[model samples]
Target: MTALDNSPNKIPSVTLDDVDSSVYSLYEKREKIFTRSIEGFFQNVRLFTGWPLLLGYFLTPWIMIDGRQAILFDLAARKFHIFWLTFWPQDFGFLAWALMIAAFTLFFITTLLGRVWCGYTCPQTVWTAIFMWAEQVAEGERHQRINLQKAPWSLEKVFKRFTKHGMWMGFAALTGLTFVSYFYGVRALVTDVWHFKLADTALFWSVFFTIATYANAGWLREQVCLHMCPYARFQSAMLDEDTLVVSYDPQRGELRGPRKRNADPDTLGLGACIDCFLCVQVCPTGIDIRDGLQYECINCAICIDACDSIMAKMNYAPGLISYTTENKLAGRGRTWKRPKLVGYGLAVILMITLFSYSLFTRMPLELDIMRNRGELYHEVADGLIRNTYLVKIINMDRKTHTYQLALSGLPAPRMVPDARIVAPAGEVVELSIDVLVDPDKLIEVNTEIEFRVETDDSLWYATSESRYLGPEPIRSQNND
Candidate 1:
């Protein structure tokens, strides 16, 4: 039995050292990744997804529908046009629901298949892939790129670097111009730039987006995903055991050692993996899948393609590194019926339904009635009570419209000015008019009035409610 040393002299004296936080930094410097090019099922899938995104982004602004850009987010005009529909600032509720739908949809997908959005559909990943391809075309393959990086300053190295950056700049400039076209009409903007007549704002934004695209896709690359993107930080909460993720099958790939092509792994006392680092070489983020699931892994499956190729060459079964579920790997049932996944799916569906309802019920005309707060009521001749109102008619349609205004609540009221308003497309028409009625017709000092606005074509109608203020009735005034 050991006795405790209670005496002060017997106890060992310890002193704490001042630890420099900078000495043990949590941050790791980013190493440039020269991802090896590979062609497989997943690469082909990227082609289908990535090419459409790039092409559609560049071409959609050029598409015209009903003499207007098919897809445009006119921030200056506060109008968003998509195909046949135009959303106004007043319809911002739809935007909120739309964002909710998008967020919940991403959550559902993340819960079902981890980080598939980042791998195949993310703008950063897609654009970065193009930039990487350009780099490879200019410098050469992954090994050649690495060699070029380490090579001393030479004409050939300078030429290769210049060519690579030139391609990136060209694409970035085109992307910027295309992005700006959604705000400024594509044809008009292109013509203006062609003639050196682009507006200062347009030129500024064009240059800004160009530099942004070039930097993000070419230079930042995985750093944007690892550090800047909030999705990577919160994706762990959305992921579940049943979620399909890019992973390495270490159980079937342990005891790693190099083996002859004809040698059996069983006799060599090794696993299926032949210690080839091709998977890590092909990873865009430069992460080793064998190290286990990491937040940095985009689930791009390039590593899977690289490993599959090596497996085929070595006469081994494929999917040594693949998109797989942890539950399946652990020999558990891999059903996707998780609670949070279902909840997210339901939320997405609910948001979609609400957005659809708002869209279908949307009207091209809107009405607003504002009573002059200065004087509640004005007395006129012939014992008449007059109330002034500022009427606003908003034309949200694609074409100009003549709207007719109607007021209700006071009996036999005469509108001093005409009730007709001519509103230009996506413009507001305001009317400062007076409504007069006999004092005997007034039931009370204050009355609720409804304003109805209808387009002359009868295609759209809208209504708003406001208060009508007047003095007490003649009978009540006499009684008082």
Candidate 2:
């Protein structure tokens, strides 16, 4: 209707053109994914593996050894107790090595199986699956639930929604409580919580974890797997064409047009694919593996199971989609003996060896020594010299121990009247001792002395070298 609109070759205003253009159109509102359930080898494996891991996390802390939590990271005391071994802050190198091993192991597994960890054992995936199971129990299956959601609110709908969310929140709190129980003894935590005596830090973290679990697993769901997990972003770098992943065999599934129920592939000039789309229905992450290797594919293989079931019903061979590598599917030679795997294997072995060696050779006791600089050497009232030294001993054990101090290369070091020292299971004990070495025996201003502490068991020993101070020896004039 305007003059510009009437002109055949009129140019549009820059602002008008820019307003119409976009780098990307507004994203379509996402459809909620409703994944169907499937049972198969991989599904069973994931289920069974997840249980033991979950049980270990929730149960290990309560296990006691020598009347103490068996695997406690007593941060308050700066000690880590694992079974019989106790790691103090001084044994931090092994912890670093252990972390390196874990990182490399993740990389190695990623390169071999391609997100198997994410699909099967990841806490996010497992928890989300559990939460969804609860949802499915409360609401009906996929299509029914969708219809229920689209329907107007009613008493039945409200009850179902409230029940589902209420159960989810309760489970989240239990998970949070289990997590915190690892730090605080589970029995103490339970009693303290019931009595309203839980520490602020403990209560704060429990609530934080509860809300996070509820949101991530119940509300956020696949969004966490897709957008929040950094692993999904970096997994591409760790994967190669040879890595086994859940893949759709395009060659065997091309020209996938629908046909008669019993249509023969040879007669119809079609590949084996029947285009049932069951593979798409069972994917928790809501991705189509048929689009080729995608970061969104968690290698869950539920799609493979669904396809296999359909294939069986159609009298066709299974594996139209399967746990396969791009190289193998592309007709390339497959070899599991790649150099990268071998290198990772060697590195894993080396790290394990180093970690074991460090643990085995760890000293049972630690010693620290410092000469009293507050007051330099004090001379006695006679022809004698005395030096003060402060010594601290740490007992790295699950039980208490007593240590007797000794000194060599010095005349005698006496405990000032009552200087006996005893260290608890994981404590540091310090003492001050004075050494009286005869001035006649002094050959130099500073004489070296060896200090030692021996535990009653004779299995632990610590030693350090310090110096005793005295007047410098006078040299006689040279005979000429």
Candidate 3:
């Protein structure tokens, strides 16, 4: 065999066209979506729901309850205040239970009604709706926005763009401030913002959330649901043929063609679809519902409203696009007794019950008793055995409590100082306790002891167990 030339200098130079260009490509360019404005039943429903949700989010932090913020997280102090209830780090189990209940509830709702949460109640959707409304106010309709985007930059365009972006930024900042107020008190946050005195950590979170809101709601609107949200990826597992979803009726809308408003669609071999493309225009995700269910579809039902309006004007029956089930569209009956749905419902109910029981049975006080480790035991005058303990009492109640401490599992134990201790509401108090026992009663190297704390009113009580250290018991010298 002839040896091939192996030297780099002997190789001919390669042209740019010789290389495959596709290998260099990293991502597809994003197309801006110009969502058209349309008003219908679903739009009205969204408006009604969105207003109340926004009001609750903005007003909740400012509301005062029992001389404190109604919903303060107080992370620095490891305390959470929800209206009248206070939660400490030890009560984190309740928070975990609440989260589990919320997850199961979402699963149950998805199994029954599809992505209603995504369409109406999701933070992304709600904020996007608000941002879109602001855009409409500043930039006219979808066609106008498209034309403006293509047109050369002018004074009017600059003004409109500036105004729209300013409004979006302001709203995003407000949202961020409100969110942070849940962890930091609203009044304090407001003062800090007004004076530009926000702490570094608070400022970082504020700016971080503000940028997130601005990007997700104003710019990344539909892309967030399509690409970022993990729920969109796994929602199919939670769905079944009987679940209600935004679906297009191909059986009724096929043979699609344009026709006169007064013409009979049957005579022209056309279905109810007028081919106006209004549904595609109004869709936030820029998807055609007639193409069938897609993961990108948020089940917002705007297509249903759009199709229904067109059908009314064309003198045709509505429901060419609607909230329906796959089974219903396939001419089959649907029942709610499907195993998956039942299982999800049961899980949700069980979690809710557990959360309720935990909340109701939560104690209003906590206690901890730690034996002093430095010295095991001390022998004072008259051969008395003395043990020192560090006692911690937490008052979870809303009122100050004067707790009376007592010892158990010992006979006539003498306690130094008064046993009465005072603890403020939602405060932890640590005390040094010394217990003196008669040497005659020393029978073991370590003795189990219980500490009890009772409120002055006797309405609340807490207890803790600890070991009392002592010298080894001495057998009678006569036996030795």
Candidate 4:
């Protein structure tokens, strides 16, 4: 509608007057949702379950184990330390197994309960719930919030918005700082934050996570689950007809109407539902359960709580909306004997077993042999074949270790700098050495040789296999 008129005379340029504006659009405006608060058994359950997760997230990094943070993923050092075990890049298999197990477990849960994790335990849901609670505290209840939203800018509206956003930002900052504490030590993080001494990487990530949390939990809210989350897209593949989801029993609730107290359904020709629209008001994603099963449903059951309360006040039976399977809603029986559930459970179990076995048997030492490829073999001063190898030793332990290298599968070989090599804890130490073997020991060229690196205390040993270059056997050449 407007453009810069930079010339001497004002003129209209780059006009879209000939195009129909309704035919195409790159942006869809979002409708603001003001979800009403409701209370029920599921609400209480979420409250109790969510607190532990929030507390654990905020508290775990502060715990000290063996003079170090209990749980830390030190990217700078390329180490991940759990409560009792430390993982290195070499132990990537364990991380793989853990991820597989988590995936299978999610599949199993989705097949049985249908997005219960999203409802009860997802970070997005939990944080959004808390943010909404803070909003309620600052701006009052549902109608009050709606009124304030439509109210013209005033001192009261500014005060309420400022208070609500202040709480949101405070919580988001704490969340970001807690995430950073999982990598940086908690005490150090606190001191650095207090003194403004945080490293650049830490500060950058802190600000990034702060903005991410604020945007996701405060502004985007349900849009993140409805549009952005990949899990919502694939959940239909994981669901089954027998999967229990928060559903409205249309058989019992349809032909819905409102009636006076002590009204008889038979005479009124109406179902139990009062058609109050409370379910819509209470829904976080703002979808009607009467619209049939939808991917937008997160199974939060807040609408169920609203319906049940309304039913109670009307002296009717509860469970007009409840966790029910499609099969059950269709007047069919639901069986627990599902092949998909069994398969997912089995996969999860198998992955867990493999992960446990690998974890318990993991070694904290690594040895790699890097041969000098510039020259294969050369004659030393005394008619000996000399092969140079760089042995890379990484000590993935908590303490220093003195390790010695030895050659095997080759007869009478001398290693230069035969003294034991010292490896500092959590550090990679490379030692360049030469292997000098008598020419008489060369049965064939490219003979297999094993380098064994063992600790002086006989506690740990690692072996790497490489080829030793030598002259071809004289007998082989004669036969050729």
lDDT of 1 at 403: 81
Off by over 4 Å in 1: 1-27, 399-402, 418-425, 455-460
lDDT of candidate 4 at residue 214, scale 0 to 100 = 99
Which parts of model 3 are misplaced by more than 4 Å? 1-26, 475-479
Candidate 3, residues 79-132, lDDT tens digits: the string is: 899999999999999989888888888988999999999999998999999999
Q: List model 4 lDDT by residue over 384-441, tens digit each.
A: 8899999999988888899989889888889997989999877899988999988775
Report per-prediction Cα RMSD to one decimal.
9.0, 7.5, 9.1, 7.8
For candidate 4, the 10 contiguous residues with the lowest summed lDDT are: 1-10
How do the candidates rank by TM-score, highest first?
A: 3, 1, 4, 2
Candidate 4 ranges beyond 4 A from true positions: 1-27, 374-383, 399-404, 421-424, 455-460, 471-480
Per-residue lDDT for 248 in model 2? Answer: 87
- Candidate 4 lDDT at 375 equals 97
Q: What CA RMSD would candidate 3 show?
A: 9.1
lDDT of 3: 0.87
Error of 3 at 62 (Å): 1.3
Per-residue lDDT tens digits for candidate 1, residues 290-377, read 9999999999998898889999999999999989999988878877569989999888888898889878978977788889999989
lDDT, ranked from best to worst: 4, 3, 1, 2
**Candidate 2: tens digits of C-alpha lDDT, residues 1-480:** 344322221122334355545453576445577767677777888889788888888788879888888887777778888889888888898799999999788888988988989998889888988898898889977656766767899999999999999989998998998888877778888999999999998999899999999999998878888889998999788777788888888888887766776678878988878766677777887777788888888887888888888778878889999998879998998887877777777888899888888788787689888999876577788866778888989988767898878888865554453344689977888877877767665667777888888887778789999888877653322222
Worst 10 residues of 2 by lDDT: 4-13
